[model samples]
Target chain A: MKRYAPYIIVVLLALLPFSGLSTYMMHIIILMIMWSVIGMAWNLLGGYCGQVSFGHAAFFGVGAYTAGILYFKLGISAWWGIPLSVVVLALEALVIGFICLRLRGPFFALATLAMGEVLRVTAENLRDFTQGTLGILIKERTWVEKTWYYYIILAIAVLTYIVVKKIIESKLGYYFVAIREDQDAAESLGINTTLYKTIALVISAVLTGLAGAFYTNYMGYIDPEVVFALHDISIITIMIVMVGGVATYWGPVVGAGIMVVLAEWIRSLPRIGTAHQTLFGVLLILIIIFLPNGVVGDFSKIKRALGFGRKV
Target chain B: MTPLLEIKRVSRFFGGLAAVMDVSFNVNKGEIVGLIGPNGAGKTTLFNVINGFYKPSRGDILFKGQRISGLKPHRICRLGIARTFQVVKPLQRMTVLDNVVASAFLRSDSKREAVKKAEEILEFTGLSSEKDKISKGLPLGMRKRLEIARALATEPELLLLDESFAGLNPTELVQSIEVIKKIKERGITILIIEHHMKVIMSISDRVVVLNYGEKIAEGTPEEVSRDPLVIEAYLGEAPAA
Candidate 1:
């Protein structure tokens, strides 16, 4: 019964578009799925591998640009960016991992944050290549309806979910956890910490790049600031994973759903729309204080607090 | 038979201080050689160098006649040398079985095979009863046993036990001695760093004593225990007539 939950949810979501939902509702769903993809990717590296990144926006933006540039320069369809960005993002992941993976803990996080900022600045400066700060515009979008985009991202999310799940259940997954728990111990026990860490980073970056490519095709436009926004792309990716659950499989999905809905609801307010970020900040603070391990991670505590189960 | 491990004048320095200075020793195949020293006498530092955690500032380490000094820890581990930590470093969130299974994966390609091997190791280490328990929740004695279980899962030819008996109670100490004996019976060479004189004196076929980063004495456990230099190092005074 528990095994079928994800498939059941996917089936229901697949049928959701035919339920006469508004365009706005479909857009929110798409955003939710997309955020979850990014969240899951981040979880692989940060939660499991213990290499928390604060610069996922770099991969996200690089992926976005890979598609955007191919469209703007070569006049090819941006959809090709989805497949092409894998190679691009992998090289990016390797270079970044080589430089940033040497630093541990918060220093690694800060280094990634700086890497994201550097990419953002680089995208803005390279006018001939990235169209400068004006960003790349996809004049002709592939889809007129949100339904197709919704299905596309849902497919990507499902793939991400399966891949992440398989890896976590394998021996590679054990190595990641071992490295996270104690690197020296992992090494002494014959696990190559650096190699496993790089594998995690590469897988994570490539998945995020896929989502970025999808965003390029769906949104029809992307500026460096929009795609590479520190708080929005990178930190929010962390937040989704954190709010969902750190290492649990379902954490990011639940986190993305709540965060996307909350963001949409807060932004829909007339006078308070601009203050949505402030609301998010408060909510994040409360979640951290109350559920440091996120919702799924602290499910027992939440159940107890709500008086849902039999007493111990 | 060639020695399983040979350390020739190994020295590890931190800044200007020599933590392990010009220390040399060897462990013959299938022998349980005890490394005994007072605190700050560089026993752990020497273990670190032997296991490739620290590169020796001078001298060479030979495992099966191959120079292994300065090799990465994992590479050294793959070359059949495995060591436990002085402070136990069990993968805290993982179960004892999972911890050993993770190490078992080093040799076995199949997860099922690794798991089967890990269970056998756990049984050997007498940790089969607590296999499902998270390592962090284990008592100090069990945690040390888990450490040995983990290292043994790597199928090492040379097992280096760093202070494996540090905090064990008398019963636990006896159990550990039996476990170590069983490990030696499997034909794996054992080099152990221990402080408890009685424990080391009982199980060790030979004992090497270090003082102030140097090999002060080396002989049978009985001989080294009665050595004048070892007595002075441990007691900070000459032995009474």
Candidate 2:
């Protein structure tokens, strides 16, 4: 019964789009779903592998640009580009992981940041192939129903959740957390820490790339900064996990919802200067200094407090 | 009865100073060998070299009749080696059960099965009462026990423990000695680095004394304790501690 609770909750959330929200609201719902999925991917590598990447924007850009170029050159549909973008970005992520994944903490963050900068600059420079920052203009799909987008995003988000959840629950995920907790100790446990870390980064990069592809087509354009902006590049997602709880399974969801909803409330209004960021900062500080366990973290604590998981 | 583990001419040079130079020893299966040395005697560094944590500047390490030198730590572990840290490295964010289960994942695939085994291990090690407790919140004694549980979870044939009795109370130390003895009864060879002379003398089948990274003497605990070099090496001139 206890083991089935997470599955039951996942099923309920999976049924949300089918529950008939309005089209505009469903679009926002889909957007949140997409962010949540991407954020969760970031959580796998950033939060799980303990290699915080401040430059997930690079992988996101690689994915969007892969599909964008294929559409412009080979006349391929975004659907076809999904797999292609994933493959391309996954390979690129592998290369980046090899070079950059060896670093940790602030150094790793800096490496990723530099990689993101280089990718953004290259996208701006590659004029003929990428339309040189004017961005790739994608045609609206035949099925432009906002409801379709919602369902599509919802389906993928559910899948992303399951895969990440599985890996985290499997021999692999245990290794990731072991590495996250202590690399030396993980190695002693027969965990190939470096190899496992890179594998997590690759899986995470591919998923985020897929999100980028979906996002470029969903929004109908692909400028380097807009699609691959650090704002969109799981940075918000990392913040979400940190606020929600960095390494927990449900942390990403809570973190994403908290920030995305708060940002939505602000973006719905007239222009506000750093109002969203200021709120995120203040909220983050409070969470960091006080509610560090995050929302669901409290649930675990509550369960323990209630003597559910305790031995006594 | 043969040497199940051997370090032959192992030397580790950092720049020019040899932290561990040409040190060598042997341990038979199921024996508890205590490695005792003074401060800066490179006890932990020698353990690192044998367990594949640090590649020696020049030497070869053998286990069960096969050369195990220059292997990555994980591969060395896969070949039936496991160790604990001087500073216990429990996954603090994880529960006590999780720390055990993570190491158990080395041998099992099913979470349910692995977790069940982990629970039993904790029970066996007298930590089932703290199963769901946050690892970091555990007292020092419990944390040391967590480290032992993790090492045991690997199903190791040879276990290397660093400073397991460093910060334990008398009761805890006695409890841990019994646990280590029970672990040995299960057929695992044990190598421990300890400063607790009484614990070493009480538990070790044989003892090796090191000074300035050199093997000063090797024999039964009482024999090594009486040697001039072992005395001068570890105890200043007094021979009694």
Candidate 3:
């Protein structure tokens, strides 16, 4: 009976929008899912391989703008654009990851951060292609489209989950863990740490890129400043993964959901608009210090509470 | 039989310091060789050059008749050479099984096959029951066993082990010695850097002694044990034994 618990929660969550929920609540739920997808993408490299990157905002923005450009300038649909964005993001990540992944420890993080800065500056300066940060406004919804946005994001989220799950269970995942554990030791054992690290970053970039494309169109606009903000760096992504539990498959999901919901909750308070980020930061620090392994490390406890897995 | 590994005057210089200078040795197929040295004698550095962790500043390293002096560590590993770190760097966050499976990934195509083989190897190294346990949380003896399991998973023809018997009780040491004996029985050549004279003397077919980055003695275990140079290198005087 408890084996069906995860499915039941999923079903309940799935049916939430159809339960006559307010539009605002639907927006929050959609936002939570989007952050969850983003957090998970970040975790593939940051969590599994222990390569922390603080430059996901650049990939996210690149994906969003790629789709936006194809749709507005080339007269392509988001259906085409999203895949293209992923391809572009994957290729770019391949190049950047190749260079950045060679650097170990904090150097890897620094290199990626520099790469993100380069992207952000290029997007803002390349006025012809990116509109110099003023951004692009979609003339109309790309699909039948408001309702489809829900299904579309959900599908991408499902795809993200499965892809991440497969990686976690594969030899690639094992190699990633080895790389994370001791890169020198892993290489000595014939595991190519560089190759695996680059692959992890590319896979992460592709999924995050796709999610970015979805996000832009769903909001019906694309702007570099909003998309490429350093605030979106991997630290926030790290927060999600760490607060949930790094290297655990569903860790990012739980962390991202809670973070997004908490952020939204803070925004709901009167006169809390400017104070929200500070609150989030403070809460993040507290959590990191106290719950470093994360809130979900107690899998048995969670399973018992949710009525899944096995006897607690 | 061809030598499994050959080091011909391979030297590594760190600035003005020669960590391993003019080091030449041959490890024969299915042979267990002992590398004995005093503290900071560059035995580990010589092993590093052989395993491709550090490229030799001069001379050739031939593995199975192919030069591999400056090859990437992973490529050398693929050429059937694997090593354990002296520091015992177990992938901290990964489980014991995952650590072994990661090495198996080097030679295996499928995850299922790698995992199955890793399970057998884990058992071979006496880590089967601790398969689900995280490696970081394991005892030092278990970590050593896990390291052995990982090295075996790569299907290496030769293993360059750095201090395999460092932190172990007598019981654990006996078990590890038997495990190493069993490994040699499977026809894998072993080059071990160990401070435990009794273990190395008993298990090694040949022994090489090092002092101040240079080889000072090479002979059969009995000859090496009685060599005045080997005793002087380790103790500054001849051993009464």
lDDT head-to-head 1 vs 2, winner = 1
Q: List the residue pairs that clash in candidate 2.
A: none
The candidate 2 chain A region of ten consecutive residues with least summed lDDT is: A227-236
Give the alpha carbon lDDT tens digit for every residue of B1-241 in model 3.
Answer: 7688888998899999998889898999999999999999998999888888889999899999999988999999999998887888888877888888888888788988988999999888898999999889998887887788889999999988889999789999999999999999999999999999899999999999989999889999999888888778777875469
Candidate 1 displacement at residue B98 in angstroms: 0.9
Cα lDDT tens digits for candidate 2, B79-126: 888999998899988899999998898888688888988998998889
Show where candidate 2 strays beyond 4 Å.
A1-23, A232-234, A271-275, A299-312, B237-241
Candidate 2, residues A136-221, lDDT tens digits: the string is 98775636677666667677777888899899888788889889889888998888888998899899998888887778678778
Q: Which of the predicted structures, 1 or 3, would earn the higher DockQ when compared with the native?
A: 1
Looking at model 2 chain B, which ten-residue stretch has the lowest summed lDDT?
B232-241
Per-candidate TM-score against the hidden true structure = 0.98, 0.92, 0.94
Candidate 2 interface RMSD to the true structure: 0.9
Per candidate, native contacts kept equal 0.84, 0.76, 0.98
The Cα local distance difference test for each model comes to 0.94, 0.84, 0.84
Off by over 4 Å in 3: A1-10, A143-145, A299-312, B237-241
Window of ten residues with lowest summed lDDT in model 1 chain A: A303-312
What TM-score would candidate 3 get against the native?
0.94
Model 1 residue B125 distance off true place after TM-score fit, in angstroms: 1.0
Alpha carbon deviation, residue A35, candidate 3 (Å):
1.2
- In candidate 2 the C-alpha lDDT for residue A74 amounts to 82
Ranked candidates, highest TM-score first: 1, 3, 2
lDDT of 3 by residue, A55-146 (tens): 88878888888888887678777557688987899898988987888798899888888887888888889898878878888778766424
Structure candidate 3, residue pairs in collision: A54-A234
